[model samples]
Target: MNDFWQQCSTLLEQELPSQQYQTWIKPLSLLEFDIEASTLHIAAPNRFKLDWVKSQFSSRIADLARDFCCKPMVVHFVLDPKVARRANGATMAGSVDSASVQLAAAADLTAQITSLNSTTSETSIGQQKNSAAAGSGWSGSPLTNHESSGAPERSKLNPVLTFENFVTGKANQLARAAAIQVADNPAVSYNPLFLYGGVGLGKTHLIHAIGNQLRQQKVGARIRYIHAEQYVSDVVKAYQRKAFDEFKRYYHSLDLLLIDDIQFFSGKSRTQEEFFYAFEALVANKAQVIITSDTYPKEISGIDDRLISRFDSGLTVAVEPPELEMRVAILLRKAHSEGVDLSEDVAFFVAKHLRSNVRELEGALRKILAYAKFHGREITIELTKEALKDLLTVQNRQISVDNIQKTVADRYGIKIADMYSKKRPADIARARQIAMYLAKELTQKSLPEIGELFGGRDHTTVLHAVRKIADVRSKDALLNRELHVLEQTLKG
Candidate 1:
């Protein structure tokens, strides 16, 4: 079974990208393989993993099994705790089990955080008593009374998220500055700092950095960093357990709350109402809240208008995809953190090609390092090109007509639907024409295909838009400047 799994892994390592293989395939445990029945039973640690494998890799696994066994083979992916425990037991007896290890780490972290909370609660209690005697007002910390109430102190914060490690550029300088301000003066400046951007643009990293900063500044500061989906799940569980008061107390007692991907809260009415009350109580007591999403607050649908308005009340900033130079800086910084001496030329080569997002850039870098380490060769431009050939091809092909339209729409402050709309207003018309022109320039799609993308207009209309933009560019200074900037942005 181990031999068969190893062979399958080798085949997958060649077929899929390095990161994809490491993320999805390598963690699979081969629990049972029957040669006579030509059946293979794979064990996934949880139902989520089982479902993901079945949806994504079932057919591929079937094919690989047949190839290896020289017969038709069926693959079954099951979530079995016994299988998981057996696998862990096989990992060097006398060593700590994985579950035990995770629990131990969690326990240690909870103890450290509880100590901080205890001290802060003591301080706040002292302050409250002193203010009571003086007949003066007191803005009590939310964590003060909660510690005695026995609420859990759990933080899903990553240690690596720190201000010192975050790379800032023109694209994200404003957002970074705002994050720093909120971290330095929580609840005082930017009460609900709203950060939104495309995926992998460091929104999560920035929020975690703020949480880590707050924890370091004040030992007793109660902080919780949760994804919106997790929060929604907690809401459902609270309803199930009939512990709404406990849920309200736990959430409302935080000094700093960071919610990532708030877009997930859309259409969840009950969760929204509960969160509305929690949001109100937290803000009434001056607790800081920060949220991240893939879209602006006003643009998020299905959420209550009042909640959206509250999101917009604070400073909203977009973290754009990093510029080319900034990407290279990020790659170099990441390499340094890993103790890899990546050169400027090679980093530039990798960064120049992987223009999608920071995640792809890092994935490419990891592949390159693996290639270099495996082959015992120096890191160079030639090596990067070889390791990233397939990725580069995909990236090049991904600059589609749809992508160009969205990029142009986002740049011009116009709706994406404007491209297909019949409204002839000057701004919308010009932006639509520019999008058509960019489609003609950037993508390899035919005129009619581009026309179809833009509300079934004729090829001649696309040609006219392209030619009109070309002619106007030579004379209109402002239009030319806008076109130049737009082209640069799209190219990046």
Candidate 2:
């Protein structure tokens, strides 16, 4: 049975992402197999995990089990709480001093929490001192994987995403400070620090910095950061295979859980249901949970209200788009890291026009650097402009409301005149709203400008149209696909 499970792990490792395989499939244990009844019982950590595995990877598990057993076998996923408890005990028993220190820290954290609740006057000063004390004695292992019950436990912190490398600006300073506080104090302060922003913001980098800092402070701390989509996929597999218990155990055991793009959880009820449990368990155990999304909690429609409340209960921070000076600093800092010589003027030139997010700024800088290297040219404002001419053209293209209306109308098989017409039919209204949304997103048009263009409607109406389309795009997968196609077509 053990051999067959190992084989299954190998096969799954080939199929799933490395992190996904390690997180969901590796912890499974083959406990028993009844040949007569054709029943193969697999042990998971908890009910949540059992359900996750059953839904997610059951078919693959059954196929492989049949191949191993030489017949059709019924697979059963049972919760085995003792398995994880034993594994955790064994891992923590590597040294007596380590265990003692951890216990003392846990005790101290409990006391801090109590004091924080009971007293409000000196709480601020007390918390500051406690936070400093918590961060003072930080001597432990870097983030490394450990062999837990033959399944490796690991964290997904990108080594490059340290606080030292993160460029602090007015845009992300608060987020960076909050992340630092979370890293230093862990669950003691901001148990769940939620960060949200547009794409290309520093959310991913900041979260990685926190994990890296925490891992550095405490050796062998169980930290797991995963994408929300990956979490949903894991839930689906577990549900199919009936292994919710194992899923629960692994996730709930973490010292810190960082989930990125949490907005992806919209419309995935089962995943939300399972994650809510895992979240409760981790929080109850004083484990830190950090999440990132592209939008604010309230703005994220289609998600359960309970889950949004959980997200809101945390210290929610936004990483806004960087200003001109910050963008220039980012570009120059990134160039310095790569050992590339970039002048202030060139950096400024690149930053002035890119004016989106940090990621786009970095991307443009990289392209310019690459272009200079490939052509053996010196870096200058002119050279930068030449290198990024095509991109700049796209960025500088005044994508007017007229252009968007025409494009969306043509794509949706509607007449362009309808955009300017007071047509309130369902299909025409839908197309008009899509055009307004696209204009808001793809052009530099304001709500008033868009409203004026679309049948002289009010600015509030245009805002409503934009919000409605954005909400529908998130919930309607087919409409989302069509929007993607439309956006790509327009861009091309």
Highest lDDT model number = 1
Cα RMSD, each candidate: 21.0, 29.6
Q: For residue 349, what is the lDDT in candidate 1? A: 61
Which numbered prediction scores highest in TM-score against the true structure? 1
lDDT of each: 0.73, 0.72
Deviation from native of the Cα of residue 414 in model 2, angstroms: 28
Per-residue lDDT tens digits of candidate 1, residues 8-122? 8899779753334543576578889998988999987544346656765787789889988899999988866664455311222111232233223333433454355345555
lDDT score of residue 337 within candidate 2? 70
Residue 226, model 1, lDDT: 91
Error of 1 at 424 (Å): 15
